[model samples]
Target chain A: MNPSMAITEAPGLFTANGLTGLIFLVMMAVTLIGGLIACTAERLVRSVAGLIVCFIGVAALYYFLNSPFVALMQILIYVGAVCITIAFAIMLAAPEENKKNGPAGPLSGPLAFITAGIVTIGLIVMAMRAKFTSLPKVNGGSVKEIGIQFLTSYSMVFELISIVLLIAIIGALVIARAGRSK
Target chain B: MSFLTLYNNLNTFLYLAAILFGMGVYGIVTHRTLIGMLISSELILAAASINFMAFNRFTAPDPTVGQVFTLFIMAIAAAEAAIGLSIIIAVYRNYKSVDTEDLVELNG
Candidate 1:
């Protein structure tokens, strides 16, 4: 009876579990591949494309992390706004003729690889060694909860950010305009 | 762990953040152009935000704090990009080139 019961339940559980696993694997692959291209691509335009792809994968990761509000904001702010602004900057400043200049020096490539690798290994080791204590969740961390918190608990911060953004816009306009006259 | 179970663990996110940070570092150290450095800096900031969000999800009592902090990061990054790009434009206008090798005027 027990053997027959196990045999019957195994296939049902496998199909139910396998589909979600496959999706997660795909997303992870997207994230890593995007990161690789963003960092290693020779052309600046390809790097920017990689950055967009990576940001999208990150947004998906945020969704998996149980923050749909953050995931949406990630897409809206990082992918939609930031990437476009960067594209504009690239179009305005970088010329194709300069892209032919190869890497800075013979040692630069190896040195940078060593430095980044060391830092990554160190951080991973620290993360593995640290025994973190989980705290109790206070709220559901939903969009409504985040909205309330922004207005009530974090209202001052929200307002300050608005002011900062305003200042940044004015400053950018002033600086960019200054170059136009020359 | 199994394939679909990647998100169920904290270490997975931590490792991902580490790799992202490494990539950012590599970009910053390389790349002759200022705009490329700016992009790399954004990558570093994103890596930091990811770490904060992961800890907030897995450990913190008040998850709102991390969300708020990440929001602040986005605001700051936006400001940084604006200011940096403007500076790049000004630099390009003055120097006629954005390559780091050519911008050295104060070097004695």
Candidate 2:
């Protein structure tokens, strides 16, 4: 994110590097705790809250990754649009009074925990073992560069995604409206 | 090398994404309600995006490409969430319940 390549000197506790490290740790904790709550909570509303928390942590992580634009999008599209829509759906469809069914068997409980554990372990091991070759960046991935590329080489895909989004909106309206007459 | 500096390593982000993806998989399989599954699916998508951004930050020859692709992914995910939630709303209207077990009328 900075014009400087890397920090040469060791960071003291309250210096910029040290403070950044602290923030990174906090974001990691937020992400993990939020993820745990999102998956494990029994209430849908609580789970959605957890999702929002998790997305915020992720957006912060994006900022750390040096892409503020994506971070902003993460907040805008996800926390703003998607989660709110889901919350509204919850209000309209599944209310608090409904008899909350527990997760179905065979896939729920200990089996699901084991499955998830195994998968997580496998992936973590793979990540730990793999060697990443860092290639030099050709250009700084700035927001303006992102915009120019979007309008140029990626224009076709961008237009296609927009069209898909349009269709999805119309289709959602029709589908949600169809059952109203009954 | 240090725990505080974990953010600088590519492996750290990779591990984070993997854990999130695993959580999503567990959620999709175990959640009894349609909305829970949809939420889990979003988690999966987020994990994928993180992986892309990590690779973009660390290794890509052209850094802008990953960010560009991630933007498109966000658009697609927004569309999917919109359509999926509407379908859930319609399904709830039809059945009066959104539980996965209650949607077995057409299973024959």
Candidate 3:
């Protein structure tokens, strides 16, 4: 008898597998709901809040994918830094109450929906038709391995990204401060 | 391959990423304000990250590569947001409004 056959069957509710699945479903729901609010909310501040919820769900998804370090980083960066930055921008610039943020043209709504629908359906179909053969993992991809790779294999890239971030920060400050009055 | 174990499947993640990407596209097309567009762009970036992490988990031989790539993506996204918001702020200062329709000097 083959040992892997048992995993093919569905686990009952209350079991560990079922509980994990339930949690996964909850995370998915949370992500989708947050995305919906982010896209559809009337107020820009509300959209930022929804984006926070969405990023948290995404971090949880990263956890389920076995990258807890990346998950934590997601929370630390996206929610902590990025969302706060966006919120500040919204406060500084967004005039949500006065101007209506509706679709530009009459056909824009239906056309956008169709375009997005086609894109999503096309990607899903492509993924379904394509056969993916998984290769054996060479390493566990743990935090330590990631650290070593950053130092050894991908050192140039890591250095480049830091430089990129530094330039972005300086550039942003220059651009935003251009029109400011003393 | 039961529904309960969908989390272990690659297609599930693929589908989720696809849907997220579609929503981002829709948001980009529909949202009229610059800040709204920036928010939607974040969704697109998140979708791309999910795709990377999924392939990394289910297919890649060296899983750390995807995580590293995702980290880079995060860095890029942060930089993008910073630059983009500053640009938005500048536009607002010049035009006194963030609405796309208002900034129509180059429209031919």
Q: Which candidate number maximizes lDDT?
A: 3
Model 3 Cα lDDT, one tens digit per residue, A1-182: 10111357889878999988888889988888888788777778888899899889999899878899999999999999999999998888876569666677899989988999999999999988888878888999999999999999999999999999999999999999997887
Off by over 4 Å in 1: A1-17
Best by TM-score: 3
> What DockQ number belongs to candidate 3?
0.65
Alpha-carbon error at A52 in model 1, in Å?
Answer: 0.3
Better DockQ candidate (1, 3): 3
Q: What DockQ values do the models have?
A: 0.50, 0.63, 0.65
Candidate 1 structure quality by residue, lDDT tens digits, A47-70: 888888988888888777778788
TM-score for each candidate, following the candidate numbering: 0.92, 0.95, 0.96
Ranking, DockQ, top scorer first? 3, 2, 1
TM-scores for chain B, listed for all candidates: 0.97, 0.98, 0.97
Candidate 3, residues B70-100, lDDT tens digits: the string is 9999999999999999999999999999999
- The CAPRI classification for model 3 reads as medium
Question: What lDDT score goes with residue A79 in model 2?
Answer: 97
- Residue B51 of model 3: what lDDT? 91
Which candidate has the highest DockQ of all? 3
